[model samples]
Target: MGGLTQFGQGLILAAGLASSAVNTHAETAPIEAHAVFSPQIVSGSDALRHVAYELVLDNFYDSTGVLQLTGIDIFAAPSTKPLAHIGGSGLAAALPPGVELSADNSLSIKAGGHAVILIWLALPRDIAVPRVLSHRLEFKTQTGAVQTVDGVPVRIDTTPPIIIGPPVRGGLWFADEGPGNAQSHHWGGLIADNGQLTIPQRYAIDLFGLDAKGHAVAAPIDKLAQSRLTDWAGFDSEVLAVADGVVRDFQDGVPTHDPLAPQAPTNDLTPTSLYGNYVILEIAPNIFVHYAHLNTGSVAVKIGDRVKRGEILGHLGDTGQAGAPHLHIHLSNSVNFAGSEGLPFQIDAFNLVGRGTEGEALNAESDMHLSPGKGKPVHDAMPLNGDILEF
Candidate 1:
């Protein structure tokens, strides 16, 4: 797994820092891994043989469990090209698509901690095909044991959408990449309004703003409890069209609330609340883009209006189930926000600002900091957690 590495701003994981995970130590229970591939099918004739999946690894170690990840090897013994290879900037959700790795190819995991590996594999028809394809996962554990995961399978999804660049633009915005929003990993996950088996949020992410030094602030507030709608730089920021398409559906006029309100967000809602005064655009055949939490009276386009890439749509707001002023964007199989399969997408390109850490130290002046994801521009990659991007 050491060649042409493709990536996306994969889901940010809740794992220990690199140093902590690198120091390997084995405990009681072994590890458990489950791989779920999307598009559910692989067409050999297609040029873009890319397949994305989520690898769930549960560390069952009892003691001070720490597993040093030497490397992940994907092969079928004599195949010329491996089906998958890991490549990504070191960030929780930015792990290319599978495992998170430092620039030096080092990674680790804590005991009882689950490392979600994001895999985006490209298939060269010369080597593999649907169904009959046989593959193996040879992972090096910290304990010197080479774990072999056999019968790893891939489904051939006949139909899926082709994702394009980021929909909206301003200075910068950030959002959640996986599960919690897309997979309904949380209790408030988005399912279909009609009750369908969909991961509409699989490619969904939450949007926020950042400063020059990669710090986030709606607007300078007096105290933590004083967050105003205007305090959010993202508030009222213009959202754009990601593609030339027609507006299929939208809901506007939902009142936005002050994030700092003592009883802020004022309403009890769920993901089923129609993305909270949102807009859904049909950017592709059978594919729609959902832009939620929009400011009331801010929508610029209307139903059936044709929009071009970069065309202004509306401003960001704290409407619906939104607790603050930010944009909630995602791609889905259906026009509705609930129960549609999540679709992967990337910004045309953006400059890498840096990453945000779970326990990263913050400036005394604010409750946030500027760190992680600092480097070159990422092409076709989503904005992961702590990611400060400028497109």
Candidate 2:
């Protein structure tokens, strides 16, 4: 392995983790698993950064008899003793039922099935990550007999993508770490298969701003109480292109949904509704940038239009499946909206303002929410959960 090297203006280093792998096994157990994992995890301070990855298990059994996946045993490379045993039932506390760490990590060829398992291994800061991650699993039959399954291996990379930071300067923003913790609500699972790889939203992120007091919004205590677009900090805020790119595709005309307002019964969200009024930029040859939930009639660019970094693209709004006015953004390998694989990115520069949960960021006093983070300014680092980053 070569030594780490800095790339571009960002302090980020690319940990030769460009190599990826996939394996399938069905010999020992009736349930067959196929999976992929990123070999690299960005380093951080006291907290442990996770190496995100995914697993797909095809339960080859009928509905009459379902197999319950009990738990996963995590192990570091070159060591035999397990490091952590995360239970599926325990995962339900944090995630929706059915995926990895659900009520029962089980399988049955039936109406509702959890197609993939999205997971991340805890990586400590500055520590030499293991070369390969060994995950051993077990499944149970209805009769209570437990059958251990083969281990799923994932590589660990200590580097991250050498991408730049917020396209706009002096902007207030923070990453919402809650929504995508499980299977990343963005690129969660096998959305579309292009034969070479299975694309999952392993690194999708939502960006929002803080109120004058540092809260996500200054709304009423009631969850359903109305908060005008102007009342929220980021509403109508300019959405900038993150990099020099050409507008490959775009969407608009969808009316902005009123926040906290009761509405007549309607159909659930569709692809268009989920990402109301959006834009896609081909920043690189293979990488595409997606900006979702823009205010209706606020898009300034059009398809095929060449755009530079920090260029005005649109204004943030409460549209689609959004609860409030905020910006939803992510990088993908393909131009397919919510159908392609997600990619990780880094920012050029951003100030750490505060750190807290969604509830804490809302309930806490403004003085504390806007308080300076103890850590120094960050360059080329992936935003972790509960991080309130200011640009």
Worst 10 residues of 1 by lDDT: 1-10
lDDT of 1 at 128: 45
Off by over 4 Å in 1: 1-51, 54-152, 156-163, 177-196, 218-223, 260-274, 358-375
Instruction: Write the residue-wise lDDT of candidate 1 on 40-159 in tens digits.
Output: 432211123444455556667667366644334344344433444433232334243334454445556677786655544445556544442334434455555555445444444545
Instruction: Give the alpha-carbon lDDT of every model.
Output: 0.53, 0.59
Displacement of residue 214 (Cα, Å) in model 2 is 1.6
TM-score of 1: 0.60
Name the lDDT value of residue 55 in candidate 2: 65
TM-score (C-alpha) between model 2 and the true structure = 0.76
